[model samples]
Target: MGMPASPAHDTVDPGEGLMKKQIRTTLILTLDDATMSSFVPLLQKGVQVKAQLGRSMKHLLCEQYGVNPEYLTERIQTIFLDGKVVDNVETTTVKGGAIIALSAAMPGLAGATLRTGGLLAAFRDGLTHEEDLEAVDSHELGMVTVKLFNLLVRELGPVLLEKGVWVTREDAESLVKRWADTPLRAIDHVEMDGLKVSLEELAGLDWSGDSEYLLLRAVG
Candidate 1:
């Protein structure tokens, strides 16, 4: 293409454009043999939770709040190694004794999105623009908690099934309950009609029955 109409052209910033367009992010995760094996089931559980929550979150945000759920601007950011964002996606690998940090953007309504409640909360009044975003931040962080919880749950499943890690759902529950306070895994499990579930399950759910569901919740 040739510049024609105007003699002077506007300056462009490629880095700014790239940053705006990028939607997905990743991090290298390393788990020890014990940790890796222990967390698989839990990871699966977290993925399920994410599948569930993604729907409600996206719907409420888009339909009600007028936010584009699929906007690349609302991306989850992840950190690998020692609390650092992974620089490359193609070469990153998850192994034993690994640490991965991840985050996702909430778009223009960051404060409100962060404040919105999880699945159970929807039963009450759903997400409200007036709600405090700090609560949403808490709920989003809960995904990681469920990820860790389900990881241990999955890891223990095999051992309990094959050899035995002496790990049970209760054990995972205890760890999660404790995490409810700290900053790392601090999200309360939602209980509906006596059926209790985690934030991860709520985040990565698929109520639509469609293929290629959103992955942020699952990946979180």
Candidate 2:
């Protein structure tokens, strides 16, 4: 006699397992208080970001990176591109190896002067970033160095970390060591050269002094 038909849910789809694995691999990291503290310093200094070339700063942040456009326009009062304050993010192109720093509204006259389109913008005219009209070779892949300061570091840092940032091996090692002392444990996995590494092994390595960047992502 033929066996009774199996339940619909009992049938396994071969593609379903692969899809689940992909989803898990690309899951965003969750940043709790302790995790934020451990990574704030690194975020403030700067982290390498991979983005498309030939996009404006506004486009890169709001569209490419999924940052809220309203937040960019309202909350992010200060923006620096390549060490100079940027007044027009729309016109400012994001080239390879560029540095973009963001900060919330600052206090005092200095803050007022540094802010884009502020009344005191004239005071810092020399320091304002001007868009380069010269043509540049565009590529499918581009890298930008992004720095977050003050409240932005706490607010947007986690998102960038989840998206993935290029960090130095030495810096990564230092971060792991610092966390070793903390009571909170947040690192889900650590990989170097595409191989997963244990926390103990990562902390023990003597990383090269030269600039060696690694894509670091924190998942909890």
TM-score of each prediction: 0.21, 0.78
**Model 1, runs deviating above 4 Å:** 1-74, 106-220
| lDDT on C-alpha atoms for all candidate structures | 0.29, 0.72
Best by lDDT: 2
Clashing pairs in 2: none
TM-score of 1: 0.21
lDDT (tens digit, per residue) of candidate 1 on 96-180: 2233332342334442333223222233232222212232212221121122232223422222222112223333433334434
lDDT of 2 by residue, 107-214 (tens): 999999999767888899589988789845364688999999999987888677767888876677688777666676665544544334455555555555445776
Which sections of candidate 2 miss by over 4 Å? 1-31, 135-139, 188-197, 206-211
Model 1 gets an lDDT of: 0.29
